[model samples]
Target chain A: MDICDLGIVDYEDALCFQTDLWRKRVEKKVPDTLIMVEHEPVVTLGRVADESSMIDRELFEKKGISVVSTGRGGNITYHAPGQLVLYPIVDLAEKKRDITFYIDFLEKTAARALNRFGVPAGRDEKRRGVWAGGRKIAFIGIAVKRWVTFHGVAVNINNDTTPFSGMHPCGESDIRVTSAKEVLGRELDMSEVKRVFAERFVEDFGREYSSQFVVRSS
Target chain B: MGKMELRLPEISAGGEDVVITLWHAGEGDYVASGEDLVEVSTDKATFDIPAPCYGVLERMIKKPGEKAKTGEVIAEICTDDI
Candidate 1:
């Protein structure tokens, strides 16, 4: 699989770009690709999200931020510059068409990445996403068409956590949001972090599905 | 002066379709931008869709608990002003 790192981009533009690329793949316009990037501080409402998911819309508007309703699965989550978002435009039919297994693999990859950073992260029994110390660090939301995957997870690394306070993250009002920087208590190298994450994703996904696809670094 | 169909933005990592679970507003109701328009459910979770633009909801082609395929028009917003 080819990995393309898009760097930092506007939230809406990134989503739009991914959607367009996803369409092209579905229509056989392009080869299956994997995209990685980060988005500006934006509040994304997921497939099962509601207005109640946001703590204060007025507050977000006052700050000149945008709220987007997306088709990805999961609740509301914050994506910002320090967070790494991965969009794997892969044909799931070539692998396995199990949605549940895909989600599990994503969680496992995220948790493994966190573990490499010396932080203990795992999946919650009842909740989705990867958590560290009972606080969520990575949020997963994705869509699949004709077995091709688009959109992906956002792992908070060096991102500011203040904006997350404006929403009831993942639509769960009781859950607290955390980041790798907060857990590590220092800034992390973005390139290095992405390398580790990409590696983990490729390793875990390949092993689970027994696919021979290599994770290309962007 | 024409009606614009409002479709669900693509959200799946695999780019799959979502199902309309509920309609927060009814047909003929006025909705402001960012207001809840409909609810969608996927395998991972259910999501509430917000109005993309401020206008009167002209019609709801899909009802509650109905399957809303991606890029399919679930409703239309009548925009005479813009």
Candidate 2:
């Protein structure tokens, strides 16, 4: 598990980098790597998601936000500055190869990170993500192939929450969205958040396999 | 025993948060197990969230186009009576 924090990058560049990295890693072109990055505001649609999910596509385009369709499992979501996005291009076959378990582990790791920030985030038994005080604070969507994982979680830090109004987030209509900064009523240092996340990932992955996990920086 | 939290699953390479593009199942709908419940979008790609457990669609926490964090609940499924 190599952890590389790619501080704030454009959405397109990061996407290209992840896809290429995943392709290369699958073909033995790269080592196990965890790349972190933040992106400008953008909306992405998933494979099975319907176009009707987007309430106002034109409005988003007018604002210079791009909407892209992807191959992962889940609907649309937003990405912007102040949010920490992590892409773990690791060979899941080398790490037990259980997709469901892997997803659960991600949720647990994210919940733990939030807990470290005193947010008390935890997994909801009925749904699939971490929650705090009845509001969603994080989102996870990923794709796995030949037991390898691409695409990861997004933890809200200081990003704006207004754009979320354009669509039914994750296809649900009643839930209110929130962020770490909003929950804590203050801004968090992005660097510190990334550090805690990296440490938490190492701990979570190590505990899952009962071995010492080393994160290599790219 | 209480409301379950639905978190986002990794769909693409970058760590960028996605925008909610659609919701397949709406509130109060009877969703079976393994049904496509919701869809979330990211800059690199899009993905659909399947129902992990079966029950009635109870509540929706987030709407389309909204940014969902990695492990936050986007909706709730009520299985208490089912």
Judged by lDDT, which candidate is best? 1
lDDT tens readout by residue for model 2, A1-218: 67888788887788788888888897887888888899878887755467777888877989989988766766778889998887888887676644566677888998899899888789887776678888777777787654567888887878987788888777767777788888889898888999999999888887965542332221
Candidate 1, A1-218: lDDT as tens digits? 66778899998788788888877886777876768898877888877788888888887899888888887877888888989888888777777665666777888888998899887899986888899999998888876655678777888899988888888988778888888899989989999988898888777777977742443222
Candidate models: Cα lDDT each? 0.80, 0.76
In model 1 chain A, which range of ten residues has the least summed lDDT?
A209-218
- DockQ value for model 1: 0.12
Identify the leading candidate in terms of TM-score. 1
Off by over 4 Å in 1: A211-218, B1-40, B43-63, B66-82
The Cα error of candidate 2 at residue A181, in Å, is: 0.6
